[model samples]
Target: MRLLLCFLLLLATTLPARAEVAGEMAAALREQGLTGAVWALVTPEGVATGAAGLADAGTGAAMRPDHRVQMGSVTKTVLATGVLRLVTLGHLSLDQPLADILPTVAIDNPWAATHPLRLRHLLDHTSGLDDARLWQVFSRRPVADTPLMQGIARDGQALRLRWPPGQRFSYSNTGYTLLGMVVEAVTGERYEAWLDRAFLTPLGMRDSTFGFVTQTGPGADPRLAMGHFDDGSTQAAIPWFTRPAGQFTTSAADMARLAQFLMGDGMIDGVPFIASDLLRTMGRQTGTAAARAGLPIGYALGLQIRDRHGVVGLCHSGNIVGYRAMLCLYPDQGKAFFISVNADSETASYPALDAILIRALSLPPVTPLPTAADPERAKWQGIYTPLPNRFDQFAYLDGLTATVMVMAVPDGLLLTNMQRPDRMLLPLGNGLFRQQDRTIASHVFMEDADGVSFSDGGQSYQRVPAWRFWLGWLSVGAGLLGLGWLLLIGLWRLVLGPRSLGGMVSISALLALMLPAPFLIWGQSFLALGDATVGSVLLAVVTGLLPIALLATLFLDRRRTGLLPWLDRLASLATLQWLTVLAVAGLLPFRLWG
Candidate 1:
């Protein structure tokens, strides 16, 4: 009787403390313009769940802990868990080649004879597959009931491998969708039904679901929170084509149960739901060169090994159209937390909430040991550009701005890039390095058939010659200057009386370049380019014709000897050179719909 009384007193003191922390998190969400948020924190002591703001801003419905929201890519974790469970049950093998599992699915892999795509590569995103293309993500038709094989056939171009399988890491939603297909291939059951029966029910996540949820149907969940944009506009629950990759709707209380199950010993009610050894393997990556070089941090199976405020944890963040979610698990310390916001606000303070929760739990910090400078740092200095992008359609833009320069500094190397601030890489020996602010080794330098390259697990950068680097920038500069000059000359000629064919060509070039600006400025959605519309069709036609116009202008004005003609010819040549670069980069004919 005395022990029971003491336990009750302890619980009474902790509840108020937890409530106070929850209040602070709510305030942080409001300050960042998020309309609604739900969070769950699980520790050895107990679990705390809370909600704040309005679930439906228009209807004035208050958010509740049981309200469901789109979990986005966090659904990958659940799918990966299902795959691992199959492995444990002897129904599948991680190293099994994808061709053996789905024989009819077309895959374009140059290394198929040697390094065939494997189940492990798909799970860890090292399968060399590109992410979803524009049409796949922004389909004009409803995707709620589209057959998996049909969808795969429609977007077969994304199945082309960018590199050898299991060579490096690159996040690919298409890879996860393939894994879902594998689940069906093996079990002869839909992935959603199998996952629900095998994992969700056992874990007691009753309110969570893996399929699309509607807003006005008889089966619609009234507890579903309405998704919001940064501008306070609401979004309807639209089904995604890649259902297994990012289509789960779950509640905070349900996520808290999942966190507890993940942090535990794979046991529920004294039954082994998953083998402890297999569960331990889910947090460590093994299919990449960086993993082979003893790098400890990366995207493993589903969760990412992340360092937050000096504490190492397994985490996964999710973002769909109008929702963002995060799940963080510190299994070593027996702590975990899940957070989601209805509004995909640019100014949302996720890091601030992370800090507050970390402080609240009093998690221990990690400090890296001091190491000697790399003796062979000179070999690592050079200009490097990221190889095949995650999205094939944007590869040209990525090559332009994502190049980086690695230069040797006093105690480390400085990584200079045009898009971000310079970062210092401190050597941790054996060709592995970490950023100055990071506690774990996150960068690896290695040599492959393509020569020396560096990787941060997700993207790899290959060394390029100094001359090639300078040539690329010079060509871009000359093209921009020529276009500006043409625009001015053409406008001046228009104001004055007679216009030459050269002046008309200049004006046409200017219009081609500026045609897509208004659509981008007003529509503010990449989905607009994914399907045939007036804007996209016009862009395709103009871009395709601009080069021909410039070439014709150059040819027709060749015999003319006046200063104006000569200058016009030179400008056309410059613009033509730029167009050649774009053509080589695969940007000509700009057919974005496919």
Candidate 2:
């Protein structure tokens, strides 16, 4: 009894220090522009939990530690757990073909080219399934008749797979939605109902529930955090059908319980929720590189598996309407953190918040060291070809010039001369750079007196510099387009004076052709890069830009030639005729083509 008392006393004293550190971390976050509740739970034997920030901004109500917010796609982790539970029961196998489970739902693809998509493919997002424009279809449709599979099938029917099953990684929300359908088909119960029976009830996640609240009934918990838009306005509730992907509401305490259960050696209150080996398998690498963390990021079942500072991490992020949530567990440390906010202000950087959580846990900081320069930067310099839709390439000229026009990257900066404010060079080591903080990582040119290598994040990427091969081709295309525009402008001047109606009509025709031509042929490939897309879109918007000015000059101006009204009418007729010809000739199809 004396020994037990001493141990308890030691543990009690140690815990407050952890809490002190965690509290300081939270205070630092509040000091930044980011405002949201944070919950961190660390346990050696049991859980120590903490929460901070407002649950309601309007009322200034303090966020409850146990209040539920949308858990986002972290719901996928739970769904994957349920599926794995079934796998243990011998009811399903990871290799089971989708056609075997759902004969009616045809996953549209050329059937003969490869092996049919299996459960592993779906969970890993290597199923080669296309992403759905969920907001476009779901928000517009009646929720009842629009089944998950059908909604996916409709949108997916048209999209071509970038790769075959298990070939590479492509994050598809539609893939998980299909998993939800499989869950229902096998269990003969709705996905949420099965989860409730098999997982939630057993785990004692009492505050968590599926579907959006249609009403705040009597005695409802006032601590329920409201989701906020980037503009700080409250978001409307999403329909329930999308619940499996990210539609469930969960409290931070309940989410911590989940983290504990997952990190708790696969047990819940002394009972096994899942076998220890299966839990590890769920956290093992199942796919090619995932996007965010910049590596061959593993995905198993539904959760992302990553290793940071020697600790294995099981994590996911949830974003729906206005709500943003993230759950990360450092399983080796027996520590986990969950964050939920009523609103994520436009200025919020959730990943940075997660980084702070790591610091709060006293984990090793990702200290980026400035390595010495390599002598081969000039060898890597040139108009390296860029992969279509994958990367942007720029030739770095000088270090100081690169730093001034180029955003300061750690090693070097990504140099995007594109006009948008968001586009800039990001640094990679030894002077090579790549697009940083982007969805798809791209190559960068290094003029560090050392050669260039493909880079993402702070490390060198394994793939060869794709930008070098494709960028040359693109430059050629752009040069040709520029020469054509200049030639047209010169020809118009020689053929008719600048004030002539024919010259104006010809200029309008040239502008119409020039505006969309570059984007249709070239810019669409780079649209995935947000800043680059904005720059490209603005450059290509001549149709939206110049036509109105040309028309106003024709109609509103009082100075008129004797033939000017007739010529103006002729030009209008010509414009209509050109549009009619374009519609009938299927020239509009080029807009949809890559």
Measured by TM-score, the strongest candidate is 1
Q: Report the number of clashing residue pairs per model.
A: 0, 26
On residues 469-549, what C-alpha lDDT tens digit does candidate 1 reach at each position? Answer: 889888988887777777788888878936777678768777777787677556545544576766677677788888898
True-vs-predicted CA distance for residue 488, candidate 1, Å: 1.7
- Residues 153-241, candidate 2: write the lDDT tens digits: 44344434434566445556677787888888999987777877777888888777654452145444455676665555554454534
Cα displacement (Å) at residue 552, model 2: 17
Q: Could you tell me every candidate's TM-score relative to the true structure?
A: 0.94, 0.65
True-vs-predicted CA distance for residue 508, candidate 1, Å: 3.2
Candidate 2 Cα errors over 4 Å, as ranges: 1-22, 111-113, 134-146, 155-160, 214-221, 265-273, 286-296, 307-312, 364-594
**RMSD of each predicted structure:** 2.2, 10.1
The residue ranges of model 1 lying beyond 4 angstroms of the native Cα positions read 1-4, 153-158, 216-219, 512-528
Best by lDDT: 1
